[model samples]
Target: MRSDTLDERSAVKLLLWLLLFVLCWPLALLALLLWPVVWLLSLPFRLIGISVEAVFALLRAVLFLPARLLGHKDA
Candidate 1:
C-alpha cells in the first residue's frame, strides 16, 4: 500500500505518540508542551536559511544570465 501520503503519515505519527503516551505519559506531555516553544525559537533561524537560499539562487541566476543570452540551453 502507499504509505507515503499525508494521511498515512499522520496516522503513523499518532500511533507512535500514543505508544509513547502509554509507555510514559509524563514525557509525552512534556514533548507536546515543548514542541511549539521549540518551533518558535527556531523560526528566526529558518527565516535566515530561506534568505540565504534566495540570495544564492539570485547569484546563480546572475552568473548564468550571459550563457542564457548566448543561446545556451541547459543539458
Candidate 2:
C-alpha cells in the first residue's frame, strides 16, 4: 500500500495461489482428470522397473544357490 505497485501486489497474490494449487490441489485431483493419459505414459517405465526387479531377484537366487552348495554361506 505504501510504495509497492499494483502489479507487484497482484503478482505476489497470484504466486501464493499458484503455490497452493501446485502443492495441494494436484494431490486431491490426482488420478481424477488425467488418469488414463498418465497411466498410459507411465506404462513403459513401470514395466521396465518391474523387469529390472525380476532380473535382480533371479540373480540373487542364482548366486545364493551356488554359494550354499559350496558351503560358503548359509543362505
Give the winner by TM-score: 1
State in Å the error of residue 3, model 2.
Answer: 58
lDDT of 2 by residue, 17-75 (tens): 67766889875366356768888999999999999999999999897897778878553
Model 1, 36: alpha-carbon shift in Å?
Answer: 0.7
Lowest summed lDDT across 10 adjacent residues in model 2 is found at 26-35
RMSD values, in order shown: 2.8, 14.4
Q: Itemize residue pairs with steric clashes in candidate 2.
A: none
Clashes of 2: 0
* lDDT, model 1: 0.96
Q: Pick the candidate with the highest lDDT.
A: 1
Alpha-carbon TM-score of each model against the true structure: 0.88, 0.48
| Per-residue lDDT of candidate 1, residues 1-75 (tens digit) | 565797888999999999999999999999999999999999999999999999999999999999999999998
Per-residue lDDT of 23 in model 2: 83
Per-candidate clashes come to: 0, 0
- Model 2 TM-score relative to the real fold: 0.48
